[model samples]
Target: MTECLDAIYQRRSVRKFTSDPVDRQIVEKLIQDAQMAPSAGNLQARDFIVVTNTAVKKKLKEAALDQKFLVQAPVIIVFCANTPRSSRIYSGRGELYSIQDASISAMVMTLAAHDMGLATCWVGAFNDADISEILMIPHNIRPVCMLALGYPADTPDTPDRIDASKLIHWQSW
Candidate 1:
């Protein structure tokens, strides 16, 4: 439990990454770990698109508002939400649930990568339509976020946090 907490605390949003390539096996492991994250009604309405090709990475960089890290990192995994899968059981709320499922999965994947001595940075600021077109994603699945993954070239200092007491609400705010 301590180790898990340690990993959680130490994990940072690494922007500068070494050029070292991440192995396919390790990426697969990270995905597997992400799948362990809980989903709404166990729908698991999420899929990951791994990008290693330089050309695709460059295009992704463009789609992500020209974040150079997208191309610098050895791997970029685009987490997506499958609305159809969630809506099949959840009806009107399924699309929202699918987005939640993908978000949680991305969080878990970042933590898992930290545990494996790898680094990850979540890229949320992107044009959804551009991402979909660049990745050739279908209509049913929407790209939630992209994770830039690799060995860290820079370890940023942890910024100060707000007091937990102030943020935590009791029975009511």
Candidate 2:
């Protein structure tokens, strides 16, 4: 299998991580990869906040339902959707697609981190109001997702997948 495909298959939501620190350059590269994710009509309305400080991570941990992994990871990426930025591009359509675009970007970031030998766990289980307040994000910016990244301390075996035949059909059902 191609390395890219291999990476895709091997990528897992790693929860435990080593104490190793990921350099800023690697984090930047992952964000660059995320920016390449496809968006509706090419209207990239996503904004990302990279948090590397321990104190900030601690606050985010609380905001993230006290997930210790949030602070344990070397870096945490906060993905937000800017309604104004998206709305200006596609008007009504942009507003509808902004959250979707942000989600796609977050997925890309996680995959890129995995490919770079770093592990990541996508954190959507949190209180939005607390997150917004802790992150100091304006109300105009909506938090969509957060990613915790670090060197993996463990990688679980790939989870089972549903049968493709059962999921796909040649034509309309």
Q: Local error of candidate 1 at 32, Å?
A: 0.5
Question: Highest lDDT: which candidate?
Answer: 1
Model 1, which residues run further than 4 Å from truth? none
Specify the poorest-scoring 10-residue window by lDDT in model 2: 87-96
Off by over 4 Å in 2: none
Clash pairs, candidate 1, are: none
Candidate 2 lDDT over residue span 27-107, tens digit each? 889989999998877878889999999999999999888999998899999999877788886787776688988999998
